[model samples]
Target: MKKILVPFCLFLVTLAYSQDDLLKSLDSTQTEESYSTATFKALQLVTLQTTKMPAKKEFYFVVSHRFGTVKDGFDSFFGLDNATTKLGGIYGVTDWLAVSLSRHTLNKMYETGLKYRVARQNDNFPLDIVGYSVADINTFLEKDQYPGLEFKHRMTYVQQVLLSRKISEKFSLELVPSFIHKNLYNPDIERDNQFSFGGGGRYKITKRLSVNLEYMHNFDKPDFYKNPLSVGLDVETGGHVFQLIFTNSQSMSESGYLTNASGDWGKGDFFFGFNLYRVF
Candidate 1:
């Protein structure tokens, strides 16, 4: 499934960029100045560049699809039940601030969260950092229960300091220091809390194409949860960007990172994932 999704995501991303190129050529009235700022901001979000970066003034929508290996309930179907889906959006609140929200579909359970940028940025400093946080809720249910069990919801909070540093015109890197807390999600799992450090790098393959990779490490006892490390690549041709990735962790959001990760960092239980983004 991961192999199939990766190519499909890239195909769609390329298609969107192609459309953007056509619009740029046909609309002679549109000024490059008007679009330059927003385009750069959108690219930053997709690329996850580390450096003081400029923000956009326009509203943008992003829809991402992620699929991984089958982890549970094989009789029902091998791994078909393990697929995850996310739909989200980010808006430029100002030239330096942006906010975002997203919802994830996890089989029968649903997760939702939001993030906001608290810091402003510029180009000379090359360290575009944002203060961001997220809160997600997951409800538990049992198949053997009476017709339908009352939802016992669990909440998780995550706070992070996001920093991006541009090493050069073609190279950039980012570091994320994050804290996560989970509750009512797992009673036996006494240590459902964690602090994590993450880093990502981007290399431009061309003006419109780039490669990116990211990894996260948890600073806690390994017995409680398995630390997750992920790597991915990004391709931006025009208006659309394509991301192809692989990781041992399956948790999709901050809350999942704290409590739901089940993959061992040393073992080989990883799967591939992809993100396809298009702007209108």
Candidate 2:
């Protein structure tokens, strides 16, 4: 009886020790880091910038269109008869960086740009920050059309710092501080350098639908140009996003739309537009 009791006691002790060791091992396992994601689905929220980039090795083909002003009241098919279009492609060099090239029909302009994610929003960070820069060349102007126009006169440059935060699963907000430089300008009426600030937001309505709004205030706008304001809806499918927009801006490039928009919303001068993005 003593021999059997001694062996049973040893077995119970060993079993209890093994169970303790197993619990400690489980407790020591690492937990995943929590982070905020999808602050903005697409790169641009209407005319304002968003801190979004494609995944590494991915490519995005985008087509954008802005019809004539709605003030035409069916004379121009309520801004459908006349249109300005842009076609662009964005390629992701890495998870945090992307490059894009686009052409606009309004001024026969070509633009190239780079977007870099400076920082990401996470449990420890409050904002997602991005840097953007672009160069545009206007090719529509003829020597005869604008006398004394040199190659340098056709160049425009834009720099922007975009900051955004996802306050909730359904709401996000962004602010953009931008500077635009035109190599040539009307000395008497226009300044060579322009500054603008933009604000935009997104509110998700359904699983795959959202409302977006954007507005920019230019500090050095000409008398004829009104500040650009746009509102749009975004619909997401599996691999494509379609945006339906109403905007007072005609130009698609940052410099073109920010500093050169000529429509007035109060006068019913806004136009209908759409942007389509397909990813590959």
Candidate 3:
């Protein structure tokens, strides 16, 4: 009986040691990957783009309106009577890719664009980076207005690289380097290519509200054009977001606002505007 008991005890000790060794090996081989998210709450922060993208299969419908300059005072109902509007929709094809189409009333413009997340901020990354490109077609121009207008001349292209960082729970900022090309340009006044730098930021004031600001400076703006500047507030309500904005730019498209904005904020030449976004 003693001999049988000694053998069983030895076997039990060996099994316990083997199990411990196996657990240590599994722990050594295990790896964990980390990811960060939500650098911005919306795809756009006022007139500037953000690094945010919708989840796969999600859709967003946006309606934007910019009224005439407040210089008209109450005569134009604070610019509401002479408003330019845009209707747009965005869809997420994948977790990191989104496509959008929009129509603007100002130039009777049609725009199509896509945005991709190149990289995201994580424990190992410093900033979130995104790539965006758009093509705009001006359909309102009549052949009679420009005697030699061609089909290709009506198109413009814009590309941008967005870099964003969330410095704190309440603050976020982004920088954009943009290139714009117009197929047709006025030989005496306008150039075919333009470059601009844009900066925007958001500061959270509450759980559902934030203050936003955006500015774009064109390096080769014509004498008649002024840089664009916008300030606004973002109010979130579940599936909808309402943006109340004041901007110097009358045009809503990137090609139009970045290069052709003519108003000055200091001179009370800014327009009152708002953007409504509904997600489905």
Worst 10 residues of 3 by lDDT: 25-34
Q: How many residue pairs clash in each candidate?
A: 11, 0, 0
Q: List, residue by residue over 1-280, the lDDT tens digit for candidate 1.
A: 3454477459545744654344454444544343212112233332232323224755556555455553433542533455677666666666555566667676333444334444322322223446665667564445464354444335667777676655667776677767777654344544566666667777777776666666666665357466666666667657766777566555556556444566654554565566665654
Point out where model 3 deviates above 4 Å: 1-33
Q: Model 2, 1-280: lDDT tens per residue? A: 3454476458545744554344454345333345578888877798776998899999999999999998988699998899999999999999889999999999899999999998666654466789999999999889997889899999999999898889999999998878899997888877898988778999999989999999888888888888889999999989998999998887888998899888889988888999999999
Error of 1 at 19 (Å): 44
Q: Model 3: clashing residue pairs?
A: none
| Candidate 3 accuracy as TM-score | 0.87
- The superposed Cα distance between candidate 3 and the true structure at residue 184, in angstroms, equals 1.6
Error of 3 at 42 (Å): 1.1
Evaluated at residue 155, the lDDT of candidate 3 is 99
lDDT per model vs. reference: 0.54, 0.86, 0.86
lDDT of 2 at 144: 93
Error of 1 at 34 (Å): 18
The C-alpha TM-scores of every prediction are 0.67, 0.87, 0.87
lDDT at 4 for candidate 3? Answer: 44
